[model samples]
Target: MITPTITSLLNAKAFESLVQSRRSVRKFDRSVSVPEEAIHRSLQCALLSPNSSNMQLWHFTWVKSPEVRARMVPLCLGQNAAKTASHLVVFQTRIDLWRRHARWNLEQTPPSSGSESDKRRMQLMRKYYSVLMPLAYRTDPFGLNTLVRKLGSFLLGLTRPVMRLGGRGWQRVLLHKSCGLAAQTFMLAMQAEGYDTCPMEGFDAVRVKKLLGLPAGSEICMIVAVGKGTPAGVYGDRKRLPLEDVVSIV
Candidate 1:
C-alpha cells in the first residue's frame, strides 16, 4: 500500500478547482487565438487516458485550417461553439484497426527469462492477445460470431458469471466508451491550460465523416470546440442533483 504525500494532497485540491472551473463554453473569443502547443499537449494527455484492454482504438482529428473549420461549422449544425472556436477536435473510434492493435500488443510482450512465473505471464499475455482478442473482435456477414458469443455467454453464465457479448452494437459501444474517457481527459487538460471546451453531439456524423474522409469502420464520438471562453459563453449557473439524491449506499 501507498500513502498520499503533501504534494499529492495539494495536487488533489488543485484538480478539484480545475474541475469546478471547467464549463461547456459555447462562445469563444475569436480575437484570442489558442496556442498550438496547448492543444498538442492536451491531446498528449488525452492519449494517456485509461482504455479497455489497452487497445487504444481512438483517433483525434484537429481541424485548424480556416477552410476546414468553416466546412465543419455547418456539419456541426452551425453551433456557436464551432463557429467561434479557434480549434475543433474530432474524437473518433476506429473499430477496424482492432486486429492491428491486438497484434501490436502481442509484439510488445518481452521474451521471458528462465523462470516459471515469468514464462507463465508471457504465455498468458500471448494467449490474451492472440486468442481472446480475436474472439472478442471478429465478425462475419451471417452474424455467426454474434451467435457463438451469445450462446457461449449464456451457457457459461448458467454456471458462473460471464460477460454477455453481442454483435456490432456492443463492439461500437465498447470503443465509444473508451473514446469518451479520452475526451474527458482532454477537456480537463485544456481547462488546466486556461482554455475552454464544448463537446457537441449535435452533428451530422455522415457528412462530418465525408468531410474528414474517415473510413467506414470509423465512428465519430464527439466534436470538441476549444478556445478562450467569453463571459457570455456560459449559459447559466451550473446545476446538479444533490449528492444524496444521486448516490446510493448498499
Candidate 2:
C-alpha cells in the first residue's frame, strides 16, 4: 500500500473538517446581532481565496441596516431568511474589474532597470496583455452572456489552441466558477468562524438591481444570510440527492 504524503494529510485535516461541519443554517435567532469582528474575520478568509491571475474579481457588501434588510428581504421572494438574519452579504461580480486588471497589465510595463525579478514581471505583464488584448477588443464579444468572464475564452475561435490556446468559449463558465468559488469560500469561512449561513436564490433580480443601483448589464447571482441559528420559521430539513447517485468517477 502506498503511504499518503505529509502535505495531503495536513490539507485533509485542515480543510476536510471545515467542509464536513458546514451546514446551510435557516433558523436564526432574531435578537442577537452578529459581531462585526467576526464578520470582518470571515471576509478576511475570503480575501485569501484563489482568484484568476490574482484578478480578485469578487466584491462583497454586508447589509445589516434595518431599512436595507427590510427592503432586501422582500427581494428574496419573501424568504424570511433575508429579513431576519443578523446580516446579509451581497455578492457582486463586476466585469469592469477584469478589464481594469487587463488594462493594468498593459499600462504597467516593467521598468527595464529593476532586478531580474522585475524583468520577469514585465515579461509576464506583456504575456498577459497578449492574451487579454483579443479578449478586451473583440467585436460582438461576450454573446451578451456575462458582462465579464474568463480571459482566454473570449479570444476563442479567433485564436488556435495548439498554436496559442484560447480554450474556446469556456471563459464565461470559468468566470462563473471562479466567482462561485469565492462566494462559497466566504460562506464556508463564516461557518469555520462558527457563524450560521443561509444561501438564498429566490429573489427579484430586476428589483435587486434597482435597489443596488447597478447598471444595465449586472446580474444578481445569490444572497447569503449569516447569524445565530434558531428554530421558529426557519427552513426545515434539507434533502439532497445521495452521493452514490450524484457522483460518478470514471
Candidate 3:
C-alpha cells in the first residue's frame, strides 16, 4: 500500500483544524442566509460516511420553506438555534426497512464465475443478508425473537467468540450510531464550507415525526440547525478534560 505523502499529512492537519474549530452554535445571524447549494454539498459528503453493513438506513429531512421552518421552532422547543437558523435538517433512522436494505446489498454483488473463492464469497454475502440479517433485525411483540437471539448468542459463545445480538433496541442503537456519524460528517462539511451547525437532541420527537409525515417505526435521531453563526452563538470558550484523563494507552 502507498504511504501518505507530505501533502496528505498537511491535509490531515487541515482536517484536524476543522474538527477543533467546530462549535455547537446556538444563535445564528438571521441576516446571513445559508445557501441551499451548501447544504446539498454537505449532505453529499454525509452520504459517504461509514455505516453498519452498508444498509444506509437513514434519512435527511431539510426543512426549507418558511412556513415549515416556523412550525419547527416550536417542535424544537423554541430554541434560538431553530428560530434564527437558515437551515434545519432532521436525521431519522429507519430500522423497519432492514429487509429491503439487505436485499439491496445482495443485489450489489456482481456475478462471478463459479470458482471456489468466488463462490464462497458470494454464498457468504447471500447468507449474511438473507439469513443473518433477518435473524438480527426481525422482531416479535412478545420478545420471542429476542429470547432466540440471546440463546443463540449464548450457545455460540460457549464454544468460540460470537456477537452478542439482542432485540430491536440494540438494532436501534446501531442505526442511531451510524446516523450520528453522518450528522457529524455533515456538520464538519458545513464548517469547511464556512457555515456553522448546531445538533439539537432536545426536541419533541413525537410531534416532529408527525409533522414530517414519518412512519410510526421511524425514529428522529437529531435535528441540526445551520447558518452563519454570531459571536454570541458560542456559549463559552471551548473546554475539554486533559487527554490523559480521557484516553490511555492500553
* TM-score of decoy 2: 0.74
Candidate 3: stretches off by over 4 Å: 1-3
Candidate 1 stretches with Cα past 4 Å from truth are: none
Per-prediction tally of clashes: 0, 1, 0
TM-scores of the candidates in the order shown: 0.97, 0.74, 0.96
| Candidate 3 local distance difference test against the native | 0.94
Q: Report the lDDT tens digits of candidate 2 across residue range 21-114.
A: 6677766888888888888888887778776666655677778677888888778887767767899987666554666667775776746777
* Evaluation by TM-score, superior candidate among 2 and 3: 3
lDDT of 1 by residue, 1-250 (tens): 6899999999999999999999999999999999999999999999999998999998999999989999999999999999999999999999999999999998898888969999999989999999988888999999999999889899999999999988889999999999999999999999999999999999999999999999998999999999999999999999999999999999
**Order the candidates by TM-score, highest first — what do you get?**
1, 3, 2
- Model 2: residues with Cα > 4 Å off, grouped in runs: 1-14, 104-121, 133-171, 231-239
Residue 142, candidate 3: C-alpha displacement in angstroms: 1.5
Q: List pairs with backbone clashes in candidate 1.
A: none
Q: Between 1 and 2, whose lDDT is larger? A: 1
